[model samples]
Each structure stands twice: as structure tokens, then as C-alpha cells.
Target chain A: MLYLVGLGLHDEKDVTVRGMEAIKGSERVYLEAYTSILGVGKERLEAFYGKEVVVADRDMVEMDSDEILRDADKVDVAFLVVGDPFGATTHSDLLLRADALSVPYTVIHNASVMNAVGALGLALYNYGQTVSIPFFTDSWRPDSWLERVRENLRLGLHTLCLLDIKVKEQSEENLARGRKIFEPPRYMSVPCAISQLLSLLEEEGQTPAEASSDDAVALNPATTLAISASRVGAPSQRFVSGTLEELSKLDEEAFGGPLHSFVIVGRRFHALERDFAVRWAVDKDNWNQVSNGVYKVRD
Target chain B: MLYLVGLGLHDEKDVTVRGMEAIKGSERVYLEAYTSILGVGKERLEAFYGKEVVVADRDMVEMDSDEILRDADKVDVAFLVVGDPFGATTHSDLLLRADALSVPYTVIHNASVMNAVGALGLALYNYGQTVSIPFFTDSWRPDSWLERVRENLRLGLHTLCLLDIKVKEQSEENLARGRKIFEPPRYMSVPCAISQLLSLLEEEGQTPAEASSDDAVALNPATTLAISASRVGAPSQRFVSGTLEELSKLDEEAFGGPLHSFVIVGRRFHALERDFAVRWAVDKDNWNQVSNGVYKVRD
Candidate 1:
């Protein structure tokens, strides 16, 4: 049996008891490391599980999944993912491969940012299609995500923007020289994502999608309310809500570390939602001033 | 400290190791039993954790929360919630009360249907605002959820319909008599939900929301495709896909038991999603005919 176990967000203890039992009974365990990272290291997990764990990078899992599923029909093999097993499409692809090979598998679900973002006091059901924001380069900057956010905003739905994490990436120079050297890991911070979004809105304002239409409105950084969540599901997690313009100028130290997420508040906020969110406001007085006019139906 | 720990979906073993540790160290443990339920009972969880577990019903949680948190500030109290602590806004309210009382608390995240629904092969990011379907009565039938579904369908996004479960509910007669008598637990099955939806659509067709034009359309049961999932995150879980008409006529026995979820498939479908869905089709040939015409792209 091939068991796709989820190491829920945070440290080693986040793994469910059932997941731990599966790990104990498994002959071989492989941890997928590229998609997301745990708060603790592999050694800590090894110490807890008391089993040797093989770290599987993107190349190994995407290219040589057969090795991961080898002899699964005869023995229990555990494949661990940082978040929920199906959080990423790649893991679903792996499940399809297992099905093709006639290898029975089971998924152990855990909390992922897809759901954990609810910790910021936003109702999960009020969120629309989630979008990912990739790091923008000097020459290549994509604005497809802006359209998604726009659609969600138009529908009065919150938008969860999953900031990108570039792990084990190679520099252009190293790639050109055929060198295996990799660059340092980079995780998009809240300010960086806000800056990219601001730039995209500015560009869109200059060149409207349709020339015939003069009502092509852009997202206002000064009035758009957003919540910046850092290290969610961790002990030191922090959530702060404010306008995009106010949040964009926030100190880098405000957000402790990696794994930051942003939520663009929609126009329709329930009184309870607004109340809960105000408690996490970066500047309580400013938030009250902006939210009084922004959020619908004051309590 | 007050700890809001999630006992993930499914059985007692679904609780995280950290949750188990908290339970072990907690002086008093209260399980919130109204929002959602686990496959196992309180006794099973009690046996697993070797601790006494108190079940908190809607009344206790909504009305008597202060009593639950009376000594929590000075003692280690665990308020256990099925799925993630933040899955329901009520729990967030409880956290707010804890904050008001100056009680430090920690949240232990676990899998909720919000994320576990991804096991059905649909991309989580493609899902729009989720809606809940309540048991329809002669006078209390609501079609507000239909608008949410329509919005999602218009955007080509999947709609996750959370079926309502009535636990420890009192009848109007019993309530009027001021009796403590409770009705048997009622879980909304897939067939019942479809019937309600179809009836609502039929009613909408007869009397349109506004008589401004005749172009206001309603969902066609015969052509709509949906996926019925039962006991998700459990070992005996099942997922079946078929046209809404066929699914509506399906026997209740086919769905097994309680905790069923329905997903109304949108217009857009990636080939991978189509292929994965077709694997669980009630009628493979019919599914192909319907999906081929329904899914936007072949690839």
C-alpha cells in the first residue's frame, strides 16, 4: 500500500496520529520537499518517527515516481507531503500514476494554507478562486492573477493570494554554464507582493483592456483593504489588516519570516467579520476610518 | 492556556500528535459537537487520549461558553473542534471571547472539508464561494443559495454544496411545549439535496425573479453534471459522478451513510479533471457523451 501522509503545517508533531502509525509501519518513507517546507528540519522528523526518511526533490518525484511506488503492492510505503496531499496538482498527478500502476493508495488529509488562511478571521466560504503570485523579474512580469482578483472583487468575494516560494532554483549564469549550483531560496513577502500588484494596476490603468471603454477601473491601493498573514499555523503566526497603500509601506520586520499570505477584502463584509478583522488591524484608528466607509452594513 | 485543537476529519486517530499532547496535558477537554462530527464517538476519543471528554452542544457553546472558559485562564483547558478550529465562525467567536478574558490560547490546525474536498480530484483553487443546503420545509424552502451557485457556474468555477445535518434538534411542537425532547439525527443525503435544487429551479422557471425579460434561465437537471461524495476522509469513502437527473433518481443506499457532499461541476474542465472524474462515472458511456459536450476543452 502506498500511503500519502500529510505532515500538517508546522513542526513534526503536526502529523496526525494515523499518519504516525502509518510511518511506523512503513518500510520506506519519502518526504516531498519542494512544494512546501515544515517549521522543523528532516532530522527532527527522523528523530520523532525513528525511521530513515529519504528527501525527494521535485525532479525525483516528477520524473521517477515509480521508485517511490516500488514494491508498494507488497509493502507499505509512506510518501509525506508538507501540507494536505492534494494541496498541489503534482501530488494528484502522483495519485494518478499510482492508479495506473494498480498500486492502491490512501490520502491522509491535513491543514494547508488553502484552509488555514481562515485563521485570519475571514470566512472560508466567502473566498473565491484562490490565486498565486509569482516573483516578478525585470523583463518578465505576469498580470494574469490580477484578473482573477478583479473577478473575485467584482463578485464581492475575498481573494486569497498565495505568495510564491522559489526553492532550489538555478541562476541564469549557472544554467548557461551547465553548472548544478543553485541559488538561495526565496519566499515572497507581503510588501513585495503588494508592490507587484500596485505596479500591475498602474500598468493596467495606462493601457486599458478595451480602448473603447473609459470605465476600466483599477484597484485602488489607498482604499483596498487587505490582510497580511505571516507564518500561519505556526506558534509565532501574525495577522494584520490594512489598506494596500498602508500595508505596502509596512516594515519588513513586521512580517517575521517566510510563508506570507495576503487576502484582499471584498465589499460585502458581515458585521461580525468586520469586527473580527478590525481586532487584527495594523493601525486600529486608520482601519476604523477606512473600514467605516468600505465595509457594508455597520453593526 | 486554552487550546483550540482540531481532531481532523474521520476517526479518533485523525487527531494530530500535538493535539493529542494538548489533550493529555489539559485539565478539562470540551468537544464542540454541533458544527461537524467525527466518524468515531466521544468515548473512542476519550479512550484514545486517556482523558475525560465533555461534549459541548450548540447551547453550551453558544450560551454557556463562559462556563467552559471559567477556569481556563488558570488551568490548561482544551476546546476540541472537529476539523480545523477556524472552520466555523462560532469557534472564532469563542477565540474572541478568550481574548476578551485575557486568556492566552493556541490553535492546532487539522483537515476540514474546506480542504479535504480536494480528494475528489477537482482543483481546490477552482472552487468559488461554498454554499450550504438546509433541509427544505413546506414554508421554509430557501433559494438564496441558488444565486451563489449561479454566480459560480457563470464563472466556470466548481460549487461545493455543504449538506446540512440536524443534530439534537427540537420539533416545533416540542419547542412550544418547552420540552427537552429531541428528534432523531437527520443528515441531508445527495438525492434529497438534488430534489430540493431541482424543485427550486422548477419554481424559478414558472415565476422568474423579475418579469423584465424571458432570458432568465434556470439550471437544467437533465444536463447538469455533479459529483456525490460520502464519508469523505474516511476509509470507506465513495465518490460518484453523473448527470443531475440520474443522481437525483439514485437510491439513498448507494451513498452509504451520513456526511455527504455534492459538487456541481462547472462548464470548464481540464482534460485531467475530466479523465479523473470519468473514472467514477455512474454510466461511463453516458458520462463521456455528457462531459465531452459539457467540458470546455478536450485537452
Candidate 2:
């Protein structure tokens, strides 16, 4: 049997008990490391599981997954994901391939960024489509996500923005030379995301779609409410709420470290939501001013 | 410190190692029972933790959450929720109250229906705002959720419908008499939710909004696609896909037991999603026909 286990957010101890059982029962274990990483290193996981785990990179998982699944019908093979198994579409590809080989598989679900974003006091029911923000290069600046944020704002729904992470990536020159060199891993910080968002708002000016509806709103750098959450689900996780103008000015040391996510708050704010969010605001006076001017109080 | 722990979707064994540690070290352990439940009973949880687990009902948690935080500053108190602590807003109220009472707290999140719905082969990024479908009473047959589904379809986004769960509810007559008696728990089945969706579609004739857009779609009882997922994170979890009409006609035995959720498929159905979802179709021929007729296939 093939087992797709989830190592929940944070350290090795975050994995569920059933996940431990799957790891213990499997004849071979492989950790899919390209998509996301646990807070702790593989050595810590090995010490916790008391078993050696094979690390499967993006190439092996994408090009040679058959090797990972070999003899799975006869022996149990466990493929561990950093979050829930279905967080990315690539995991589903592996599961479907297992079906074609006539190997039965089980999915052990756990918390993922999709749900963990609710840790910032935003209701999951009020969220629209989830979007990902990639690092902006000099020539490749993708600001299409701003329109998605606008669409969500049109419906009074919050948009959860997943910051990008570049891990084990090769440069163009290295790929041509067939070198096995890799760059240092980089995780998008909340300030970088906020700056990109500000750039989008400035670039999309005067081309903004429908701005007349009573409940309709747009992303204004100074007036739009925003939130940044980093290292969520860990005990030391930090949440900082401010306007885009306030957040885009922060340095790297302003908040916690990597794997940060930014959120564009919707116009339909409730008193309860405001009450909870006020505690984390960089400027409570600015938050209240924006809440009074732009947000539509539900109750 | 107050610890808000999440007992993930399945049995007692689904709790994380950190959760177990928190339970073992806490002076008082209270399970929040009204928001949702674990597959196993309190006896099983008590046996696993080797301590008595206090069942905190909705009244106690909402009305007098301060009492739950009593002495939390002096000693550790663990209040567990079935899913993540933020799945329901009431948990936030408790946390805010803790902050007001000078009781520091930590949150341990787990799998929730919000993210667990991705198990049905749907992409989490494609989901719109989630809507809850309450059981329709004879006098109050509310269908506002149908408009929410339409709004989601207008944006080519899938809708995650949370089925209603009523537990330990007092009858109106009994409540009027000031009696503390409770009624048997009622969990909404997939068939019941599909029936309600069909009823709404039948009632909402011709009042539909702008349908001239190329991708705009409406919920047709005979053609629109739907999926029913039950007991999601458990090993025996089941997922079945069909049209509104086909799923509405199914008996209770067609799905697993309680805590079922329904999804209304949107227009943008990718080939990968279709391939994965086709395995759970009630009728493959009907699925293909509907796929060809209604779904906007995204290659």
C-alpha cells in the first residue's frame, strides 16, 4: 500500500499520530522536499521517527516517481508531504499514477496554509480565491494578482495571498553548463509582498474597474487594510496588521522570519473582527480611521 | 498559558504529538463539544489521555468563556476543538477574552473541513467563499445560499457548502418551558443538502442575473455537477460525484455517516480535476455528457 502522509506545520512533533503509525509501518519512507519544508531539518525528523528517510527532490518526484513507487504493491511505501497531501496539484499526479499501477493508496490529511491562514483572525467563509505571489525580477513582474484582489474586493471577500519561496533553483547559466550547483533558498517576506502590492496599485491606477457600487472598494496603498502572518502554527508565530503604506516600509527584522503570507482585507468588516485585529495593528489610530472610512461594518 | 488544541478530523489518534504533550501537561483539559466532534467518544479520549476530559457545551463556551480562562494565568488549561480553533468564530471570542483577562494563550491548528475539502480532487485555489446550509424547516425554508452559489459561479469559482449539524439542541417547546431537556442530534446528510439545492434551483426560475457573459453558468438540477464528501479525513471516507438530480435521489446508505459536505462545481473544470473526479462519478456516461455540455474545460 502507498501512504501519503502529511507532516503538519512547524516542527517534527506537529505530525499527527496516524502519520507516525504510517511512517512506522512503511518499509520505505520518502519526504517530498521541493514543495515546502518543515521548520526542523531532516535529522530532527529522523531522530523523532527513529528511521532514515530518503529525500526526494523535484526532479526525482516529477521525472522518476515510478522509482519511488516501485514494489509498492508488495511493500508499503510512504511519501510524506510538508503539509496536507493535496496542497499542490503535483501530489495528485502522483496519486493518480499510483492508481494506474494498480496500487491502493491512503491519504492522511493535516493542516495546510489554505486553512492555517485563518490564524490571523480572518473568517475562512469570507475568503475568495487563494493567490500566490512570485518574486519579482527586473523583467518579469507579474501584477495580474492585483485584479484578483480587486475581484475579491468587489464581492466583499478577503483574498489570502501565499508568498512565494525559491528553493534549490538553478540559474540559467548553470543549467546550460549542466552543473549541479544551486542558489541559496529564499523565502518571500511580508514587506516584499507589501511593496509589490503597492507597485501594482500605482501601476493599475486610472484603469481600475467599477468603483461606484456602494460596497465596491479598491486597493489603496494608504487606506486599504492588510495583514502579514509569518511562521504560523508555531508558538513564536507573529501577526502584524497595518495599511499597505505602513507595511511596505518595514525591514526584515520587523517581524518573524520566513514563509510569510499577506492578506488584503475586504470591505465587509465586523466589529468582532475589528476588535480582534486591533490588537495586532501597527497603528490603531490608522486602523480605526480606515475602518470608519472604507470598511462596511456588518453589525 | 491557555492552550487551544485541535483534535483533527478522525478518531482519538489523530491528535498531534504536541497536542498529546499539551494534554499531558495541562492542569485542566476541556473539550469543546458543540462546534464539532471527533469520531470516537469522550471515553476513548479519556482513556488515551489518561485523564478526565470535561465536555464544554456551546452555552458554557459562549456565555461564560471567562470561567474557562479562570486561573489560566496561574496554571495551564487546555481547551480543545474538533478542528482548528479558528474554524468557528466563537473560539476567537474565547481567545479575545483571554487576552482581555491577561491570560496568555497558544493555538495549535489541525485539519478542518475548510482545507480537508481538497481531498475530493478539487483545487483549493479555485474555491470561492464558503457557505453553510442549515437544515430547512417547514416554516423557514431559506434559500439565500443559492444566491451565494450563483455569485461563486458567476466568478467561475467552486463553492464549499458546509452541511448543518445540530447537536444537544433544546426544543422550542422545552425551551419555552424553561426545561433543560435536549433532543437527539441531527446531522445533515449529503442527500438532504442536494435536495435543498435542487429545491432552490427549482424555486429560483428566470430571476437569474446577467447570463450573457461567456463563462457565466447557473445551477441546473439536471446538468450542473456536484460532489458529496463525508467522514473526510477518516480511513473509510467516501466521495461521490454526480449531477444535482442524481445526488438528490440517493438514499442515506449511498454515503458514509454524518458530517457530510456538498460542493457545487464551477465552470472552469481542468482536465486533471475531471480525470481525478471521474473515478467517483455515480454514472460515467452522465458525467461525460455533462462535462461536454456544461463544463468549460481548461486544458
Candidate 3:
């Protein structure tokens, strides 16, 4: 039996109980590392699952899936993914390969970013579309994502902007020359993304899509953006909500560290959400309204 | 400090070890239940966390966030959400509220479906926009999603169709009558979603979107869908890939149970992904060679 298990978002213990069972039962365990990875290291997962996990990079999974599937036919093999097993096409490919070999397989899904963007109080149903903002280069920065965000805003839909991550990426020259050179993995920051977005809005000629509501929430390319930085599953994770301009000026020191993402608020902000946003708006009083309640401690 | 932590996709185990530590250390732990839920039940999570969790519904969150934020000022508090905290905007609102109150807070992120959809080998970067296919009533079905999907198709980008889920929603009549009423939560199935899509396409006097793609992979409105059905994060999880028509005829007995989603393959199939999809194509041997290694996974 081949088991494809998701290792939630954080450290080792994020694996579901069923996934844990599969890991324990499997004759061999392979952790697919390229698709996505836990904030914590592999050793942490190994310590928690109490199993030695073979780290499978893109080469192993994409170039040598047959080897992984071959063992599945004879033994209960478990392939661990950082998010949902089917979260990446490569993982799906792995499943297809397993099925081709007539190996019975089960996918143990876990939380992925698709559903998690709701943390900003935006209705999941109200989000029109999601697009990734890639790191801008001197000559090859793209603005296609900006147009999509415009459409979502015009349609009264929120836009979830996924930042890009460059992992084990090879330069065109390296590939052509048959050299196994790789660029350092880089996760895009919110400021970098917003800057590129600004340039896109300029290039696209500033035509913001219209929204369903009477209010036109478009063309505010510099509108309020909710930013979250270093949201590792760790207790010290940090989130900041402010206008894109304010966020743009955010000191890297204040945001703390890497893996930052930004959200462009669209139309259809409920009155309740507006009230909440007001608290973070520039120069707002009664900030203490957020502090007038009872408290409880579990520990 | 206030902590908004994502519980990932499944059960208590889905919470990252970092999230677990935060929960263990927090003065209080409140599970936000209204936005979305883990595949596991409340009781199961409580048992695993070994803590008395306060269930905070929408009413408690939207109407009573002050109470939670106030506590955070004096002590550490953790609001647990399914998937990533930022996956939903309500959590973002909560963070903004916390910020206004001078409450130091953090966000522990998890995997949400946003980036996880790469499982279909669809380049996350290539996706133009995402649209939600809501549950259509006898008289109130909306076709706006169709227009949005059309725009995306024109741009040659993959679309992630998020099916709708109506939970704890009241009926129109109930709101007018001022009576406490409830409606059953409805999760949109891929077959029903396609049926609506086709109907709406015909209504718009447009050619069926499926016709543009190769017929084998193009799922007409009545086609059975390639559905991943099961408690994605739970133990008995299952993923079944099939046609929209075939999936529509699926015996409930065979699909296993609730919480199902479908992936509509886009036109631009990557070479490796096509290879994988061919293995699952309806006619494995007579597969269309889109590329060297890419094939659509058929139902």
C-alpha cells in the first residue's frame, strides 16, 4: 500500500494521527521535500515520528518516481508531503504512477494555503481569484497577476496574493550547459511584491476593475493591504495589518523575518469588517475598544 | 500577546507542534468554528490537545472580539482556526483589532488550499484567477462565475474553482420573520457544480468551455468529475479521479462520504504532469500525446 500523507504546516507533530499510523506502518518512509516544506527542519519531523525519513528532492520524485512506486508494490510505503498530499501536481503524479503499477494507495490530506487565506476576515466565497506575485528581476518582472487582482477587485471579490518561492531553480544557462547549478531558494516579501504590483499598475495604465457594489474599490493600487510576515507555525509568528503604503515603508526589522505575503482588500467589506479595519486605519482613537473584555488562561 | 494559529486541514493532530506549544502556553484557547472546520470533530481535537477549548462561533467573533482582545492585553491567548489563520479574513480583522488595542500578537500559519492546488500539476504561477461556484437555488443561481471563468480561460491560466459551503446560514424568510432559524450546511459537489456551469454557459449563449480543450480531458457539464472525496485530513481519506459524467452517477455508497472537491484540468499541461495524467486517462493505451509525459487523470 502506498500512502501519501500531508505534514500539515509546522513542525514534526503536524502529521495527522492516521498519517502517523501510516508512517509507522510503512516499511519505508520518504518525505518529498521540494513541493513545500515545514518551517521546522527534517530532523524535527524525524524525531517526532520516530522514523528515519528519506528526503526526496525534485530529482528523486520527478526523475525517479518509478523507484518510489516500485517499493510500494512490495511494501507499505509512505510518501510524506508538507501540505496536503495532492497539494502539488508532482505528488499527484506520484499517485498516478502508483495506480499504474496497481498499487493500492490512499491520500491523507492536510491543511493547505487555499483555505487558510480566510484569516483576514474576508469571506472565502467573496474571493474572486488568487494569483501569485513573483520576485521581480531587472529584465523579466511580470505583471499578469496585477490584472487578475484588478478583475477580482472589480467583481467585489477579494484577492489572495501568494508570493513566489524560488527553490532549487536552475538558471537557463546552467540547464543549457548541462551544469547542475542552482539558485538560492528565495521567498518573496510583501514589500517586494507590492513594489512589483505598483509597477504593474503603472504599466497596465491604472484601469482598476469595477466592483459589484456601488463603491468603486479599484485603482487604489496603493490601497490598504494586510500583511503577515514569518507566519511559521511557531508561537512567535507575526502579522501586521495596514495600508499598502504603510506596509511598503515597513522596516524589515519590524516585520521580523522572511516568508511575507500581502492582501489587497476588495469591495464587500462587511460593516463589522470595516469597523475592525478602522482600528488599524491611520490615526484612529478608541484603539482600546479592542481591549475591553474578559480574559481566560488555559495553562 | 494574542496568537492566531491555524489548525491545518485535519484534526487536533493537524495543529503544528508550534501551535500545540502555543496552545499549551496560552492563557486561553478559543477555536474559531464558524469560518471553516477541520476534517476531525471537536471532541477528537479536545482529546488530543488535552485542553478545554472554547468554541467561538461567528456571533462570538464578529460581535464579541473585544472580549478576546481585551484578555490578550493582559495574558497570552490563542485563537485556533482551521487551515491558516490568514486563510480567512476574520482572523485578519481580529489581528487588526488586537493591533489597535496595543495587544502584541502573532500568527502561526499553516497550509491552506491556495498554494496546495498545485497538485494538479497546474503551475500556481500560471493560474489567472480563482472563482467560487456557489450552491444555486431553484430561483437564485448566479452565473457571474461563468464570466470570470471565461476571462481566465482567455488568458490561458488555470482556474481553481472553490466549491461553496453554507454553514449556519439563515434563510431569507427567517431573516425577515425575525425568528431564530437554521439551514443545513451545503457543500457543493463537482457534478452539481458542473451542471450549473453548463446551464449557465448555455444561458450566456456561449460554447461550452469544455469544447475548447481536447474532448478526452474536457469535462462537459454532465461529465463525471475527477473528485478527491473524503475527510482530507482524516484517517479514512480517499481521492477518486474520474469524469464529471461518471462522477455525477457515482453511488454515494462508493464515494464514501462528505467533503468532496474536483479539479478541472487546464489546457496548458506541463510535460511531466501530462505523463502522469495519461496513466489515469479513460483509455490508458490510446492516450493523446499532449507532450512527452503529461496526461490528464480521468475519472
Best by lDDT: 1
- Give stretches of model 1 more than 4 Å off: A206-218, B206-218
Backbone clashes (count) for model 2: 0
lDDT of 1 by residue, B148-184 (tens): 9888877778899999999999999999999999999
Worst 10 residues of 1 chain B by lDDT: B208-217
| Cα DockQ of the candidate 3 complex | 0.30
Model 2 iRMS: 1.3
Error of 3 at A157 (Å): 5.6
**Worst ten in a row by lDDT for model 1 chain A:** A208-217
What would the per-residue lDDT of candidate 3 be over residues A111-214, giving only the tens digit for each residue? 65555545545566566556777788878977767667766666555677777878888898998998999988887777777777666656656544432232
Give the Å shift of residue A192 in candidate 3: 5.0
B88-117 in candidate 3: lDDT tens per residue?
445656677677889987666665555455
In model 3 chain A, the worst 10-residue window by lDDT is: A290-299
